[model samples]
Target: MNARIRGIFEDAGVRGWMHAVSLDEPEASVELDADAVVPMASVYKLPLLAGFCRLVDLGELDPRERVTLEPSARTAGPTGLSAFADPVTLSLRDLALSMATVSDNASADALLDIVGLRRLAEILESFGLRRTWVRRGTAANLRDLQRRTGVDDPDAALAVLADNDRTDPVGVYEAANASAASARDLTLLLRRLWAGELLSASQTEFVKTTMHRQVFLNRLASGFPHDGVRVAGKTGTFGALRHEAGVVTLPGGAAFAIAVFTHAARGDFRQPRVDAAIGEAARVAVDVLR
Candidate 1:
């Protein structure tokens, strides 16, 4: 790791790990505590997307199938269909797209219902990702927050998080049956996906193209702003944790699968410093690999 990169993370008072490997030369890479397990937050959606694609490839599920869901039946979140007050109907492919492009909670849970949690795990195991798993959906995470804080509402639970009171919010965040993964494991998953080892060609393209449409670009994308370098990433944010994992493709046909995960020393939801650190850390790792 670069000294400046180490300083960037150290100064932010956050625990971070990064792993980057080039698609053209998988053996060439950089790692900093890459094996450390951290809360994946929405980063779990990447694997869920893959699992959904696998089902599509196997003819077990149809991406064109339409499903309807009401707000009450879906997970509570502030984006996409989750934020709508009325019932919304969409194709399974569009739902997966919403989950990847906007990190839509409702879309994720709806797709999770179709893909099944056990099937998602089976897909990851087939890819050799032993340390990654999603215990439940986003709605279950919200319920866990309510249970831990003794608050029955999502806004109240968030207020609890913002106030930074009631012992060990981080502990509660980690203890919740949310998804989890190690940085190394996430990077490897991306590697396999890019190497044409995870899904069929068309299915893999669907996953990659959806990732390219992600609306959040403050983390991994912030690091690489060059004209021809394209970044397709998914970000995860909850409590003191912020993570972004995806593949960064350069103009020369070189691509690096990178995963950056962080937990702030101070549990502040508005901490921009930690977010910037994530970008800087990933920038350093990508530079080294490049």
Candidate 2:
């Protein structure tokens, strides 16, 4: 199973790590380079959401509290509230929903400001995820990208990333300031969440439901199309990195937490093969545990 999974990544021309563990029996698991640190991209939103939910649970935050954001206040992104031209008012709960469901940069930045990086760090520590963290918010990440590449435009920065001969890819990747995690740590986090160890039962259900509403499905979900199986996933993509982490639940109440992180050999932004490999690799890992 490990060789087959490694072959999927090799065939896709990318470095990959994966871990899948059965929720019904956590001892049943599969892994490959699961402890290697990798860029998490937008996958940080998962922990951010958990932190925000924790605040709500502690009575420290009012989910119904309304905030108005101008168009300029939003982080630069292609989707959701970030793409809007007019000022918008939203409840804190809706902002989190937008962040989780649509990967809304604007909403994420807003929530991060409210939750604060210190609080997020505390949340990860509480969950025993020593290697996972949010170094900075999305806006800071984009600014760092421009600063490091000497390119004011995102497209130009991406072009710099694509030129391996002229640029140090590792330096560029580090400059992105994305969240970081390992497959083992992420999978363990999910397993604990599913086991009701990270959050209360109701809050855990909220997190799972938010993940279930994710609109992006080209990665892990593509591999498991069985009608009886339900996937609740979060996807992250930046530069040559693509990742998806989530729980797949079978009809008989059996579930597995899977995390697949990959970095392509080339910097093409639209690599369907890499995306397919993510799903295929995750499917193989899940099958082994099943």
What is the C-alpha lDDT profile of model 2 across 208-231, one tens digit per residue? 999999998889988888878888
What is the C-alpha lDDT profile of model 1 across 42-83, one tens digit per residue?
898899999999999999999999999987788888898988
Once superposed on the true structure, which residue ranges of model 1 sit more than 4 Å away at CA?
2-4, 164-166
In candidate 1, the residue pairs with backbone N, CA or C atoms under 3 Å apart (3 or more residues apart, or in different chains) clash, namely none
Stretches > 4 Å off in candidate 2: 162-170, 175-177
- Determine the C-alpha RMSD for candidate 1 after optimal superposition of all C-alphas: 1.7
C-alpha lDDT score of every prediction, in listed order: 0.84, 0.85
Q: Which 10-residue span in candidate 2 carries the lowest summed lDDT?
A: 167-176
